[model samples]
Target: MSTALPQSTGVIAEYRARLAAGSIVFDSAQASAAERLQALWAKLRGYDPHPKAPPNGWVGRLLRRKQVDDVSDHPNGLYLVGDVGRGKSMLMDLFFEAADVPRKKRIHFHEFMQDAHRRFHAIKRDNPGINDPIPALADLIAEDAALLCFDEFQVHDIVDAMILGRLFEALFARLVVVVATSNTLPDDLYKGKPGRDAFLPFIGFLKQNLDVLVLDAARDYRRERLHGLNAWYVPADTRADAAMDHVFTTLAAGAPAQPGSLMVSGRKLAVPLSVPGAARFDFAALCGTALGPGDYLALATHYQTLLIDGIPRLSPDNFDEARRFVTLIDALYEHRVKLYASAAALPDDLYKSGEGAAIFERTASRLEEMQSDAYLQLPHLT
Candidate 1:
């Protein structure tokens, strides 16, 4: 490692410069980790006693080496596990800034899945040769010394669970090293998921190739930084009233702003432009149109209250969505958000198919909460 950075360090030097400018305050252990990584980078680049590797040729090698897995070469992959706001991204940003691999890519876990799923179906028609795009994409990634970094790596969906095994198998088989950060441990990545047993092979694959590392050495980093931070709202603030008024008026309009239409599993759902209602549009129309977990998630995330003109007669598909909907609602409820619904039947009566009655009983608590005036009277979430 050199005290002076070589001019050829190029993009790596610029990334280090940004790291120097970031508002990160590392503690003793983390500071030592950074120091060790930096020292390792110095050793690999053969830059002698130079100050910080001149932020150029010597510095860029650190990021480039992350994608290189050869035993005779620099170390591959970095596992930076910790709670949020621990400067995981900050540390990685320095590495990314210096990385010169043309194929280098980083994506948030949720966002990455959205893209992968979208492209998987979209490209199928054009590239019929590629039955599944995820594995193909992984193979493409293995082509160059491109670094693939995923933030917030937690598996949640059946689609991801089904495909992740093949994707990772092809990736690791091609010698691609992944750098990921997760709140859950590697073995516990998709714990408690429905049909999770089907994904065990991928879990086994990850355990074999990826190293699990925990970065938190003290209290939660987010809590430590915002320990005494206070939230203040002025008496004159009218934002709450405005949001409520919008929801009421929108519901009064009798339909969603955009006409709802989605093709799911060869079923076409065409919702009317409007439904007769005072406080909300037709909930049956909305929920009936939803064909997958994503639709239910979108509904829960966007609307707090749903008033159905007709009580849904639950079917197999509807039952599955309802179960998933309950999970989404529970997550939102845990986050202190509220849900309000008008249904002809109660939770015990809402099932036509599904064996998770015990879980549904727990979910019934949330359904009860939705009927409470506290949730129903609140302004719509923007």
Candidate 2:
């Protein structure tokens, strides 16, 4: 499906209009990338839909023409890499919305893999003796979506790592275009996995098929918008609770909050409330249980901002919870994940007397720093 370009205007012009209207902040690097993506979108508009054909004769020739049209006319897909909160996801959202392709889909990478695994199971169940499933699965996906946009592209599961090279090779062979955003570059993907050497060929394939662009703007645009906003609320009350809810709604762009879960070390960590880029939890749900740094790190990696509710003051009676809170704070701080919380008291007064009171001083200091403009502007760890 083709959409008429708004008169002669392009995506760059639309973006500039947003800047002029104060709807978005202007960033030169991001604007340049958007211009390039607009060019790619125009090239994609040239190709017709994939043709249907029998094995041989005139129909077969039409199939060959389809391949040539795509491979020769379409530019390489994009691999957009940048620091967290640098507007990579936001820019890609704009590109996806503006592209007027009927056979296109944009999804989070984790959700995509989950769907792929489900497809694998269904294919195996239906065709018990199939020698190879990846090609068939790729064909099915290409039939549905000629263009695939993936957000937060990451690989942690060995099962996923092993299958991606073959699966993506099949997709590309069938002329499926893929655009992805990630905090890590193509070369650094799956770094330090137990058998990382086996994943190298996929990296090579990605480099050959996608034009890697870095959006290395110095400012963290999300943080800039959040400058001077209150992050910590003491004496948790109805007003503080309402403020937390407002912040979550604002950052999530009005997406409805729902329960979210994270799979860490084969266990599900429950989240009480979540939208696309942020999550909220109760203190008991997080620190009251036996969670460690690994769990916290997983949360930090997935959510750009976290909101914790009902943090009671720390004392000797709740020493274990205090320790857990310390670990959680450390993990969040190290990853530069933004924190919003309602507590019984301020950070310095939270743990007046506890087993780890001395060490808690540093935690207190970090908590204060996390609320500052300078610390909020730091890029998140990928």
Candidate 3:
């Protein structure tokens, strides 16, 4: 493999330019991964997706190549595995942006699976006699995307785990290339679940189909940035709000701001700004509403990080809000969800001299512990 970059049109050149401009630091592991992505980018340039359906359907043509003439030339995609705070997501985003393929998409794993389920149901509804809708769903995806890049890929739900193996096999059968970044390696994913035996094949499928790159960079750029910027902003003023906004943007990695809803215990929790494993919200959204333990637990299960703005000073007057905030923090602390917030005062000062001030003290102490480097290093539990 040549280390020399082919041209300015691929990932390597863009990475090199970022390095020169001081926008990014030089990391050897990142450089190597960028080179590999560049190789695929060059190959995908003007490459045909071969969307024409055969006279016979997908199953009949499964053994044949997507492009009969280019069977040996199709590039195998990559899977980047690493711990939290590593540059896996950032690098993949860069590669996806620089990739020359006209039919390409980048999506978070959770959203991808949600879309999959939605598409499968629609197909089922339309064709009540259809035996299996997975292949048809795969066809829709393959037609739109030759290159699929997934960020924060992990499986905790049994439903998603059960379907992934069959789904990916169908996608690969159509010669759709896939690239994903995951904190859990293929072998380590979906462990300790009830259907572990059933999901093992999907793990093997991942290892067999994609080349794995372990990104063990010397520095965790995300954690370092968090440390420098001071995630906990006090006074809850406009500047604090702006600072928290920056924190959300940095953690989100250029993902667009979008509102969404998550179902928990048969109810819906509205999300103000949803970004895969990270979420942003105003204080009122959580504490101002009638949310309870189950809702907070759902939030803790889904999001690894939360950016909250406008945390006003709590007193006996707003005891309801204070109690709710305490519960929210308890859920986050228990789940090890990293929190960044704009609060009117320090944790100790919040909810001072209230009826449940003593109870609030424990939440304050937990919040203090959560800001430690050791706590920040801990992985978010589902």
Candidate 4:
């Protein structure tokens, strides 16, 4: 009988060290994010599926060459849902960053929707000959990676509600495994909006393709840390220079909120300047304008933090305006933006009118997201 040669312990130790340090760049060409993800899948597939079991210990399985699932067939498509600050996003980030996949793309859900909307319009205007953009989009995704991850998956805007089908169809067509974390269940997204019933098909598609898992521990991780007065809302104490100084100092430490109007596809936003440490944005005028998802998307890309005041009422015109406001805040939050807001009342109490209760629900959810410990940890002043 042929005997296997003894493995060198020194070499094995070196290999482990290299892997831990991320110095073992698996053949860049071969061990792509997609491939790395497949490696993880291979490792996972070999493990016992039972609730209680030890790690995989089969030598034969280890010796055999494993097949990584194509983008479409990867077995671990995931849907993680829970209340804010319950570590949903942190878990997603860990999975996306550590899991080996041949090609991997982790997109903030809001940003992705904004991007999809932007591309759809661009394609429509530029290539009118193409009846549908889904096919081309699918091909592009297929070429890039076999895995995709999204953080804070949500659907609120008319634009998002309209394109859910085409976007998912393209992504799913490529056979890419999707991992998404959301505050809302897939079925409950955009629940109360007008014509929301139309989105059922997309929800059905998600349910069929993804394994939904809920991490519903009631404890709000965000609120636990914010229990005391230390984190409560506090406006800048000093007037004029102190306020502006605090704003500038706070903003400069994080992403610089450059004083410039943002433009998206010919739309212009006139940004007001702060004297030294204060913001110049006219909240009334900004909210009063024709606000929509597009406007928020533009602001999100440019500013990581926003402070808005003077919200008298949260009516439909106000709700629609605030919807964009919420979308912008969501987008910024997805990008890890710091937000500080002051209104006549708290978000939950902002709009308590007839038939407009839905806006309050959305507002409460957004406020929770903003107050999450992860968000709070970002540089901010009260």
Candidate 5:
């Protein structure tokens, strides 16, 4: 089997070509930031074509040689913070793809922390006497990835906030360069949280270890795309399905949808199709099942946009499903998640004859409001 060749031009050049070709809107600030990141990538790639192994045992040295080059002339990593839809994630993606490195991994920050928690548990299980497993965990990660790119870096969980300082300290010590994108600045991370003072050191550590840059673009690209477009498409049909598919693909930026699961209060909620920043689901997979407010809230928090297909007319026969749908809408509404759905009827016509028909009126109102420009302009709850 033959392998595919990487692109010859740098990331900034490629981005400029896209702008020239009208594939993407031109934003001067975003382009400038991409140029800066491209410089960093060039420095990183130029450091060592052939790395020498550490003075460990033969097996250890061999493993190290296979993973990363020498830790010489490594540049400080990047912390790109920007407003929602300001092209931060898009720039990071380009940087990750263009970087020439033997070992690099790009992942969402929430997923990274989940994996970190699982690894911590496993390491703790094996090394029972160790008081801290973070160093060993960081070593394992460094063995596989010298460059770590994280998207949508938001700190919401206290468990993560408490451990990040020590964990990142160890990773930096091992020369694991990280590039991350977030909506909040380093100083604003975990703001207004209880015991947030304990999380401050991690913020300082991040500031010292990474070159924080802001993508100061004024336009929200996502909202611009949504302008005058119908967020809710009724009479779910072949045309509506195709339109929904196009919208999801556009929002996902060519990333293929993957199957994922969300753990909500000891229950596993299956997501049929998902890419970073968006998810697509069948109405039955969500409302026909026994999902609750917590499950929908978790989904709203995770994805900026949710595309639901095959929303059917509700009746007394499927009262429970209708009730669940109402709760799901409420959760999505509260979180300001952009909702796109192909439905059997208009929101008002969905639940015409149900015991909760009066309550369904509120859900219908919220659904209509969610499609409005005001709701589309609201920032997503992370």
Candidate 6:
């Protein structure tokens, strides 16, 4: 209802506005979590993230200003955890949008890690003798933002898991406040994985640095939304395209889709439409390119849900593209990434006969299963 931003704006107020307008139904769990975020929002008001410098002379050096102001003593942040569609990210986004911070960023955790590794390597390459780049990376990030918010916070790569503890510890020490939304709790992170013992300390450190709130809302709102639409659309018509657009908008919530990059080995693969834990792509962009299993795997790993547009009928004439589509489906199926697409034909009818016919059977079967309720209910495997 308000057209302008105000200094006193808070997440609770925004949530109530949306609730009143019927944009969202009020769940007690979401309301309680909003209160916690509101508390943090209040603490963050008028809180300066920049460190003050002492006089820049011998006296300053003598004083050594060992401390960089009181940034390190800033308030602890909040960590929101819940099942998918429980509104953990929604609430976090509300707080991030309304917070009155001069320097702040809200990013998906996957892309953050990808950039982290890239920067970490660059730092090491630039400074050959620098053994640890985590502190430097943290400092670099802190200079840009005193507040960082992450969506779909998750860790599966051993490399990322190893570096996270140090990276985040340094970030906290620099007075950077972090807010994250995840489907898992702090302790369950990297659980059952090898080298998990070393990761245990990081989990404990995270718990200490942030207040964790669980939002086990009674309904699966995201699933409920999906239930109203057919997961796959046939004939690739204008109506199908409109429906695809709606699906993408609904799943992305209020986050804007942006052109993003995925690090595959050492190469950067371009993602045309990246929306937090979801991505949208035209069939040509995905299957017509010279991409391999590695590229598709990277896509599957990054986006839990994919909205694809204009998947043409597969046949002998476009055998290469058809094969690539099969590879893409295989990767998505393996990762349990939910798919929504506009296609020229149903999965079975799309690949009726050709050189790819034999192997296409598996892909067709997987596509059908992917559209089923049982498959949609399964959690994506990282």
Best by lDDT: 6
Question: What value does the lDDT take at residue 78 in candidate 1?
Answer: 58
* lDDT, candidate 2, 295-330, per-residue tens: 898888778789999999988799889889999999
- Report every candidate's CA lDDT: 0.51, 0.81, 0.82, 0.56, 0.82, 0.84
Please report, as a residue range, the 10-residue window in candidate 5 with the lowest summed lDDT.
1-10
Off by over 4 Å in 4: 1-72, 230-382
lDDT of 1 by residue, 160-257 (tens): 88877987776664455566766567777678888888888887877776655566645444334333322111121254234333444443332344
TM-score, structure 2 vs. true: 0.73
Order the candidate numbers by TM-score, best to worst: 6, 5, 3, 2, 4, 1
Best TM-score goes to which candidate?
6
In angstroms, give how far residue 304 of model 1 lies from its true place: 20
Error of 3 at 297 (Å): 7.5
Compose the digit string of candidate 5's lDDT tens values, residues 1-382.
0132322366777787778877688788997897788778776773332243344579766755544354344568999988788888888988898787788899878768877898999999999998989967877777778789998888988999988888997777677789999988999988999879999989988988899999998699877765566778878999999889888877866567899888765578889999878889999989988778888888987888999999999988888889899889988988789999999999989888758889899999999898887788776766
Better model by TM-score: candidate 5 vs candidate 6 = 6
- 155-263, model 4: which lDDT tens digit per residue? 7777788788767865665455678877789888889998787888888878877777776644554444334312113332334334434544443322345566655
Which parts of model 5 are misplaced by more than 4 Å?
1-8, 46-73, 252-276, 289-298, 358-362
Question: How does each model score on TM-score?
Answer: 0.50, 0.73, 0.80, 0.51, 0.83, 0.86
C-alpha displacement of 47 in model 4, angstroms? 18
lDDT of 5 at 362: 95
